[model samples]
Target: MGSVTVYGPPISTAVSRVLACLLEKDVDFKLVNVDMAKGQHKSPDYLKLQVLSLPSPLLLHHRTPTPSLLVLMSLILTAYADRGNKNLLGRNGGGPAERAQVEQWLEAESQSFNPPSSALVFQLAFAPRMGLPQDPAAVELNQAKLAKVLDVYERRLGESRFLARDEFSLADLAHLPNAHYICSAGKDDMLASRKNVARWWEEISTRPSWKKVVDMYSAPPA
Candidate 1:
């Protein structure tokens, strides 16, 4: 198979999530940076490839953009399971029940964790970087929402080492990018304050795949 190409800036949570998945699967891939700041993502040529044209990270294997983040990650798992990350979707060494549980947590991350975490990351981390004013009301509101979600996570983690019952599946992987930024936003207490959640976060965040993505973000531009 040709090397898969992922197009988007590393700093984008969606892009970084894909990158980390590729890494975990041990899939060989290339990253083509999209400069959102220069309006390149909205360019006519880009829109042809990605109709949504928003946080658009096109996976080149399909020769078209997979607009949904979940779809893109599912595609990666389908294409690269032999590369040895099938358990991410609970395909290897995991039964149907376990697979269902993995999906459950993936949904939880999308519906529960993502909303407030994304808001907090943007309001606290991205806004200042773009010279946009921080809305205290937004921050306060998201913080409360996120705290409630983390509370659920805290209890869940107590029962399992990772979100989907002791395995670090896509369930946990999905949260890395935004959680990283939330930590940078000085709101890591949201995770750190919860004992079980803190332990789970440390294990997943320190994985080699995610560490590589974080290093790419920290590295000086080429």
Candidate 2:
């Protein structure tokens, strides 16, 4: 098996999300912290790994080149068997219909949930910590956007136990990192205001994998 290395900051929700997935799948990985504060992620060496992108927490599979499909299948089977969770995104990921549903919610998390949630966290938490001014307009805008997104979640969750279905899937796991930070930032009311959403959040955020990540990386109180 090739080595798996994750490159990013410990506190970054994006990095934490990947970590939670890896942990849930019981994959052995190496965490290579990139100091964004020192602009290490922007260095030429780091940029080469990421190519033309700036997203941190890049996952690199280290080994001699081989058939991509075989590598992917092997990794998936190994992780799925180790964790015994059939709903994660691999060989055990379910049938076509279920897989499509999971993909849909995963897309929602990346597009709808992440933008406003991440923006609010940045405006309320990271910006101030970095000595950057918080823009009231941006904060208000993102809050409203997140509220709308949660409204949809509330409706959907009322109909189903998990986002994609009754089963716990990657769709639900996708929300943990940013949701943790946002809740800690004092906007938990956004989740609590929606009964089903709150229930769902409570369930997913308490998983052992996420608990470990939070224990390791959550910021201290101001």
Candidate 3:
């Protein structure tokens, strides 16, 4: 098998998500930095791999490029689960029911959690860094939206240690990157204010695999 190469900087939420997944699955891969600031993502070469201009990570393996972030992570998780890394999918070898539950939470994260969270991350964190003006209305709207989502998560997490069940799965992993930025945006209260949600966040965000991803973000460029 050829080496797996991920194109995008670690700061990108989608890229970090894939990086953390690869770490959790114990997969070795190379990182090829894409400076979105420099419009590198718009380069002809980068666009060739991701024509959709999706702000997601691009994965190159065996000369094949996977452009969709969800597809890339799904492929990694399913491939590893089939190889005995069952926890990536769900608890107890991820039976059909458990797998279904995992997919449910994954959908919730994508549909419910991601929209508001990503908007807030962009408005509060990225805007300031990129010299773009933050939109106050957007921030307020997304804050309310994310809070509502977290309230539901607090209730669900009270019953289950993870989104799907008592075991950590891709469902929880899927939220790590966005939630990390939400906290970084100085809106940690959205997560920290809810007890069960806070506890869940602590557990998942502190996982050694995720910590490694954070370290990668801070690592000096080669």
**Where does model 1 exceed 4 Å of error?**
91-93, 220-222
- Tell me how many clashing residue pairs each candidate has: 0, 0, 0
Q: TM-score order of candidates, best first? A: 1, 3, 2
Q: Which candidate achieves the best lDDT against the true structure?
A: 3
**What's the CA error at residue 122 for candidate 3, in Å?**
0.3
Residue by residue across 8-31, what tens digits does model 2's lDDT show? Answer: 776887777777777877778777
Q: Candidate 3 lDDT, tens digit per residue, 99-173?
A: 899999999999999999989989887889899999999999989998999999999999999999999988999
lDDT of 1 by residue, 99-125 (tens): 899989988998999999899889988
lDDT of each: 0.86, 0.78, 0.87
TM-score of each: 0.94, 0.86, 0.94
Task: Using lDDT as the measure, name the better of candidate 1 and candidate 3.
Answer: 3
Evaluate model 3: give its TM-score: 0.94
Q: In the order shown, what is each candidate's alpha-carbon RMSD?
A: 1.5, 4.4, 1.6
* Deviation in Å, model 3, residue 57 alpha carbon: 0.9
Superposed model 3: Cα runs more than 4 Å off: 82-85
